[model samples]
Target: MIATYSGDTMGTSWSLQAVAARLSVVRGVQAALDRIVAQMSQWERESDLSRFNRAAPGAWHAIPNEFADVVDAALMIRRASDGAFDPCLGALTERWGFGARGSVDRVPQHADNGGDNRQIDFDPQNRRIRRSVDAFLDLSGIAKGYGVDLAAEWLLANGVRHFLLEVGGELRAEGIRPDGQPWWVDTEVPPSSSLAPWRMALHDSSAATSGNYRRGFTVDGRRYSHSFDPRTGQPIVNGVSSVTVLHRSCMIADGWATALTVLGPQAAISLADAQKLAVCVIVGDREYISRPWRDMLG
Candidate 1:
């Protein structure tokens, strides 16, 4: 029998399913997830990430291994996406009222643009980070995906081979179910459409979807997406509704999804082609799938 456990976390929810039916294992998994939230949550003032955000400029702050790993992934993606996906948009996120400070009625005159990846330095040897500039770091786009990966690793370490783990909308699946069926997941259809949901069978891989439909606000009849473009210090005005990425690591998939969403359909497709990444981008009424992603679907 497949055992399941789920609870609220990271301002959202997390779910885990494993082949072994053990309450002890489930409890261990929950504890592990809780630790991740305590370390990485932007909503939590005492989180490791929060402390790093508030750290003095040019001062190196020692971070937990997991936190460092997530940062490393974010930095790599920031370069790969050509700065399209940035973790340094914390100040911008707050200025736009998307941060822990809450939303505002209108956009601010001067959005604080401090958190560019170039301003931050990581010393992997010591698992510490320092910022050259006074910038706030926000890992919302990629932290949850890393959380999912952590949970998956915990399960594997506990000898649970067949499992599906999800933190927020980011997820990873492996092996087969108890009944020998492949693990399946459904993609969210655009809210404006009445079409059936898209489904995919996952096996030893991770998938993450990033979209502006569910997380945004309208101001004076103008809608602003939570996905911000670091260069403009403003929410993206792209036509793409959502972008999903499939990769060996959920962290990479999650970061890529956010980066590709900011890039829109045309540019995203080009980057996907160049990087040979498996991607599916939803632009208005149409869906664009990369050749690598289409093969994954088949």
Candidate 2:
């Protein structure tokens, strides 16, 4: 028989559906997720990421293996996405009221890539890093997806091969259902929209969506997106509403989702096409699908 477990972590909810679930399943998975949170959560004052954030400039600080791995992935995506998927925006994160402080009183300025890009250097061999300037390294964009992957690893290593794992709406699946069907999930939809539902099958794959509507505050009738452009030091105002990415790794999916959302429609789609990424970008009342996405569906 299949069993299900659910709980909260990293400011979001997580759930797992596995075969022959034991009492240890929840504990095991929770432990795995806690590992990531303790290493990467900027919310935790003593997390490895938090410590690194406060590290004196030019002084390299050692990071845990997992934390280093995620930073490596983030930096790769940052380069691939032309710095659209940055991790050194913790300062902007707080400025826009989405950081460890929870909220702030500041009006967001217009978009311009002229702001400081915050220079952070990673030493992969030593599993350490240093920064040239003081900036918060926020993994909020991608850590949740890594959390989901951690949960999946727990389930797979514990001999539960067939399962579906979800954290904060990002998801990963492996093997097959007891009935041998793929785990099906729907992409996020805006509130009060009558758009037709889009579903995807997760069979050893993952999906992550980034949307402007997910978080932000409205001021004087103007709405802001939680997804900020690290290059601009402000929440992106591009007309793109949301972007969903499918990949084998949940972390990559999460990072690409944010990057594509920041790139807006035309440019995002162009980059997705160049990267051969399976992406769906929603802008205004229209949907833009990449070639890879169509291939994935078929």
Give lDDT per model, in order.
0.83, 0.84
Candidate 1 wrong stretches, greater than 4 Å: 112-118
Best by lDDT: 2
* Best-matching candidate per TM-score: 2
lDDT of 1 by residue, 1-298 (tens): 8888788777888887878747777676777778888888877899998888887788899999999998899999889988898887777788788889998887788845434343778999999998755467889999888888887888888888999888878889988898888889997667875556678888899999997787888878998888888767778888888888889899889999999998889899889988888998987788888889877756
| TM-score: model 1 vs. ground truth | 0.94
**Lowest-scoring 10 consecutive residues by lDDT in candidate 1?**
111-120
For 63-103, candidate 2 gives per-residue lDDT tens digits of 88888889999999999998898888877777678888886
Distance from true position, residue 56, model 2, in Å? Answer: 0.7
Task: In candidate 2, list every pair of residues with a backbone clash.
Answer: none
